[model samples]
Target chain A: MNLRKLFAGAAVAAVALPVIAVSAPAGELTIPSLVYRTGPYAPNGIPFANGYADYWNLLNERDGGIEGSKINLIECETAYNTQQGVECYESTKGEGAGALVYQPLSTGITYQLIPKASADKIPVFSMGYGRTSAANGKVFEWIFNFPATYWDGATAIVQYIGDREGGMDKLKGKKLALVYHNSAYGKEPIRTLEVMAEKYGYELMLLPVDHPGQEQKATWLQVRRERPDWVMMWGWGVMNQVAIKEAASIRYPMDRFIGVWWSASENDVLPAGAGADGYLAAAVHAPGADFPVHADILKHLYDKNKGAGERDRVGEVLYNRGLAAAMWTSEAIRTAMKMHNTKDPTAAQVRDGFENLKVSEARLKELGLEGFTYGIEISCANHSGPGRAAIQQWDAKAKKWSIVSKFYDRMPEITGPLIEADSSAYAKENNITARSCN
Target chain B: MGGEFLFFIETTISGLMAGVMYALVALGFVLIFKASGIFNFAQGVLALFAGLTLVGLMEKFGLPPWAAIIATVGVMIVLAWLIERLVLQYLVNQDPIILFMSTIGLAYVLEGLGDIMWGSDVKVLEIGIPQGAVDWLLDDYGLYIEKLEIVAAVTGAIMVTGLAVFFNKTRIGRALRAVADDHQAALSVGISLRTIWVIVWSVSGIVALVAGVMWGSKSGVQFSLSLIALKALPVLILGGFTSIPGAIVGGLIIGVGEKWAEIYIGSLVGGAIENWFAYVLALGFLLFRPQGLFGERIIERV
Candidate 1:
């Protein structure tokens, strides 16, 4: 009789284990942040990860959770490697409330995750950087690169140059050099730049620097020889700093030398000292910690000693970018709940919410991000919101970046056709039908 | 000369300066290989560690530059003694492959310890090294040369001369040469092989620190400073592993050869050929002369 009783208890325990493993905790939204706090890119990755974690913490602490459903933020270290990022996504995607959304923060990992996330019915918010073609929502139903994309950045750069060179007509016969990291991320904007070059009649000089670009003596020597009218950089990590320093070494005009968004940061310029003064970079949002959202973060997180990183580095450019990404993510979650009429919406419902998401100027002010960035509205037809960018100059003496130009409008005439062609090719390859907005 | 010919000359001069930097790193490797018969793969990380320590001492502890440098040197000496006592003592008489693998593990340990000590954020290593293009060079001959590179070249020359004098004239240098020839024979002669290993590693540590300071100043002190080891590898292969002069000659050849290839040959294949051009040159050289330009030729009987 005792043996039979024991066997019955064991059988019940065995049946409950798998059920417990599969089920998410009730009334909690789990958002897994794949971060890199180690490795070569840690200097840049740490602040971004910290800003992301702090924003979520601010939402949970100050607001008592978004609509009373507390957020369970889980951080997994990826070290900025794509393989590790995929593993992080696989391990954390099914935890607590089924992972409402994902922000891979890496283009290589985003490319790897686009199909997986689509099949899993999860929304991917690549924010500003990813496959620019994913902006066409007809094919990329689950992927969103709101605010801007790399191709948009390239167009904005060209537009800014056109404005500086007197006019689009004045761009003819001008030599522009591109010193880019040799990677998919660096190569993404080439075709768009080539198209713009053809239309504008500017000579494009392409220079590729291998990964972990510490040595640029040869590349800069070529830059010296060519004597291009303007130099543009598509660089990241140590590459940006080294390129800036090398340019400074060669007495390249700081004002004319521009960098894509990733290449422009306090981390990049601070190392180059006074030589980095007047360095220009394309920006998607205003820099510095003056926003009201920063105050709320300080009150809710840093004041309570729960801040994710150094308190002094709270409002720097990359930190603010991370905060902006988290804001969009949380707002999307709120939108999902409101549309579904349920506090605990699954990842698929959140994807639906993303497809119809809109954040206006009023909403931006309400969220304490007034004048921080432009409004974003993601829809079925458009995954990239507005695709506007501005130029910012690094003032090394002041140790800050200030907006030096108005937002350059996204050139849809050029980018639209490119996006359509690429997304159509991708759709055909994957056998995916383009979905209609209506 | 035509404008294009002048540009080629300017590129060659720049390439030669870059080669001198690579040779500085290779010099550290040659020192350890000569005395200890170990490749000392951690030489690059040792440079990084030294830079991190020097920067940490100055920034965190607020030591004066001179005091911080001296303290860093002391730290390297202690590290050398510790490595000898802890790692080399246990691994003595091991196969060359095993010793090489141990140094790789040591590299990782040093790298982690460096990050933990200095924090991972890139720090400006301003040791008062003058930077920017030399005005005189640019104006006189239309040749652009960085002041920092000229300083590095002068420093490298001084270091090489000092090393040559020490190795040829000192009694300790003789002892080190005896140990390099035969460990058992050195022990029989009561030269203390272990002491010679510690001294040799300490000297290598000093060389690494010098290379680190130069590189850390050129670029910020960061993790990538350790990658100079990869650059030094082809130098070691070209200049026989045991020859100091060979390292210098090999570095210049690889550097100038790669630059010329990237400029002239790289365009045919869409540029960026400097990355692999050096390794290919070294490989081609090895096919013809298995014993490098300066490496001691080895003969064996079955």
Candidate 2:
């Protein structure tokens, strides 16, 4: 063979070495983790994946596998690409006793998997992302985006801005620029913001940053010209860090600039150092490793040196978000097990469990996450529970984020009709009947 | 000044500075292509690896910033030498496409290696360069200008001047030029092809380091920094692959054009045109001046 052929062969071998197929043993409850561990978004994706894996490992190590069925967490690396996420989903869906649920951790991936998972009878817990209309479980039955959605985030951010300006009526004639990543994920909140703009009379300026947003000189220059009263971002991964840096470089007041939950993380703010101080973002959970679940994770995982990430990063914002996602999914599994009266409940039973899920404040306290997040209550019609979030400020000197506001419940007046309209449109296009919950 | 004119001035100045940043990465590509006739796809990854190494040294080994930077330069040189020996040496007389493919492979290997050596986490690379907006510009002229962008502009100027001097005023530089003209003839005339290749690659590596430091400081040192290579591709296309000065001028034109397009025209089209606007301008350049503004016209006889 030629030298070119030889080198090509070697390259193929190098690439194929690390890809070990995940096959679970029988009688185990498999959870397909569609993770992006090696990509542009790895900085944020790493902690979340670690947190997610650590939680499942904690369940396996401490609770003897979520009430006697060993948890089989099969992590498939997506590299944050939509096609790779679908490939991961297809490859891992039939691992062992079949996959119970999927937490794709990506809006693009979630959008793609919504119909696929629905048809396959597998449930997708997109957490705070995916299509905001997916919150209408009557149309999007198998997909669950609980706790909050992007539309909820937009309204909450607007509410916070209005409160800062004294009242909702004070927002009239004010300019608010939405610097968002130019994708389905980033554009998720635009409709809600536009409606809010119409209602409150704030002039909305939209600036879209493309994927892996490393260069933003043009976008920020526009921000300087527009000189908006407040700036809100719906960015993710490197876009968040770059946007924050650009905002700081233009002497934009960091306090007036806010980011979505996905944009708020140590990875996003720490790079800007002292300039990021007072930069705010919406949060659904408390940060830091002070929670009892973190202590248990420390004991059952990190203390034994079996943690998925660094021992110190147990309670980071994204890590906690991931841990919370895992906690709720596992709770749904337990609910399925109890309702079905079997340890090995099917994927359909898990869907039922998620539909009927209600994690009250008392249960949160019992789970050692009492103050970490608000109570969740899901129903057949409402996959999005509470849809509430609080604003958090970054203290760059201390290198930590602290919640600074009470959880603001989403405006049903705004999102209800929008969700109904969008989901109804989706149902009409797909020729599917919306399920009646009542 | 009228508010519209001030905004225009602000946009132009910012675009020039952003262009200078893109030119910094393009210079490395120009260097390797000038000497070897092979487009080095690994240049951006080289920048990323250098930044990763510099930050990794400071964090992992507790080295001071100066020491870590010096050590990173040393690492880049050694890496250049290794690339020369392992990859380039074996593919010496092969097709240029083969060489280009090798660099693509090299890019992935270095990216993965950087991730493995220093875990794939966003690292704040603080060598104490001034960041944030320049206060006097903002206060006096009411113009927003980044201190880091100013620093990048000066750094790009110094690098270009030094490289021009090095390429035009040295014996080794002449040897590189001779090799660029005709590798076989240069070898026959006692100009060592291997030594010239190694030298060109080392210079490119240092360029990568400087580009990495500037860009990494702006947006924390991460894997996405490697994607800045995409920004430079248009620069190379418009400016000519083999001219360093062409890179800067092309970068400025593309930058100002895109920024103006995005600001003026983008608003009408619902925005986000800056990403594709650069490539479109480069395509226009390709259609008009395929040889680029500064690139030498080939006079091949039939």
Candidate 3:
């Protein structure tokens, strides 16, 4: 009787093991998106979050997920606060297939998650923001800020100004002002700009605006008195709108005023009305919702009444940026699958894939974003891809932004050394051994 | 020397214009505190709600600008009545801190409701307020002044005069002042405390609407509209919480002082001193005058 009972218990256990395995499928990929859907920055955050979610949803509906492995996309709200962002990261990192990658969408949060992500063997994609020196993959293997860094942006803006001034030599004696937010994200470009100033013999004036910068009467008053040749801004949220309005109030030439990518959006331009007509900003992707991928999104998501945000805002600049980030994430997952010959890859495997990823022009066309953005390539030694950017001008009359310049080459001569120096310093401070990538 | 003097003058004029808007928000706090003896901390959220309602009514219902303004004003009055009935009435005779804390909770509720009603997009409040710099001023004095700011200054002056008249000349206003002075004595003389509280809240709501229009017209109507309350706190601290005239004088002092500090002293310290200059000035002033610039002095009897 005891022998019979033992055999029966073993048979029942075997049956239950298969059921549990089926319920928690091994071939599922989980991506955790730390979003700020409600906060002072919600106007900017909501569209980006919607776009990110929509792109993934389109993939699930159209292609049945990446390489036949269903994607489990989980969103956690951080309200644009760093502490909440870390909490969101910790809580959601253990869900489902266990967060293959994290996109914090905030520099402050990305800074906090850098060490934590390395320890957890999960890759972090700060995209266009965060610590600019994280471009040096030797010290920051788990972090990726591709397309461009703040230093790259600062150099590109200087190049654009040089082009307008006839040549790089003409930049000498030119006075340029930088109106930036008073935070780590805002101060990222100061050192780069200063280096450029010393090299080109131009004067760089720095103006720091307090957070949520609604009041800029004094700052612009200084602008009027000094009358810098060009005013470049690194503002976010309400700060961008107020600066533009104040710039207009001072009768400053709008064409000469350029803002960083964060300040270049319809929400920023609309507040200042027609006075923002000639305002220019740095952009990593083309603006508007005219891409073929947008049509797929509309048909699969909005048309079926499953859209995440306003249907009209589907192709806005920031929306397209979010879509671009989601595409990069999906491509990296595909690379992991191809590289490891596995239906589902671990977080560490995904990091390996991100290191070896390349999104060519042909791939973008196939993905229906042919002209939506420039091609991006990442590797073991370099994390910030190609570091190219374009200048976009807001057409106040049309209520949209248009790319105004061809892609400017990334100034690796200026940024490369800075990244090496900063990253090396960080490595020594933290007792981290720099990795050798062959 | 000429350029420096001209720049200083330009900064002062611009600072005064900005100060008027701060005073408008501070006046809302003074009105409620004087009549009800409750420091209504939700004044800034009230402005945000008022702006959101105006914009929402215009956009969602397709109402014309004037019609939207009227409808929004009606909504604010109804909101005041609801607050008096649902919140204030229940918590009567509570500690002032309790009342202040209740308003803070109300601010959160109103802020959440505003976002839900209007959607969380930054909206342009275009009631046809003039934008762009005044060309003549720019040509004559090389001074750039936003025309919209000039309109805001004039509007603020008119609103302050109207409020001053309403507070001093009307029978209900006189009774409201009586309640502010001594609630028990006013009640004994047949003045209704509930009626006075409701009236004061409604008046403050109107002041909030004016501020909303001015500020919403300046910047966009968004979450930052609620943050303007933080800006008004320094103004209140400088002017005294219960004085309307004090609110305006305090606002000018802070606005001008900070602008000057940012221009002259800011560069020495790497420029962005406007944020803390106002608070520092208020703190320094408070050390000298414990009752504020115009607050009623308290004499304790042991």
| The best candidate in terms of DockQ | 2
Put down candidate 1 lDDT per residue, A326-424, tens digits, no spaces: 988888989999999988989998888887889898999999989988887888999998999999999999999999999998999989999999999
Candidate 3 C-alpha lDDT tens digits along A230-253: 999999999999999999888889
- Clashing residue pairs in candidate 1 (N, C-alpha, C atoms within 3 angstroms): none
Task: TM-score each candidate.
Answer: 0.95, 0.96, 0.96
TM-score of 2: 0.96
Clashing residue pairs in candidate 2 are none
**What DockQ was computed for model 3?**
0.64
lDDT digits (tens) for residues B1-302 of candidate 1 = 58789889978887788888888899999999988789898999999999989988999989988999999999999999999998998888899888889999999999899987888888888778898889888888778888888887888889888888878889998888888888889889899878988898899999999889988887788777898888888888898888888888998888888889888888678777887898999998899877788998888889
Candidate DockQ values, in order, are: 0.60, 0.82, 0.64
The per-candidate count of clashes, in order, stands at 0, 0, 1
Per-candidate fnat, comma-separated: 0.58, 0.88, 0.75
| Global lDDT scores for all candidate models | 0.89, 0.92, 0.90
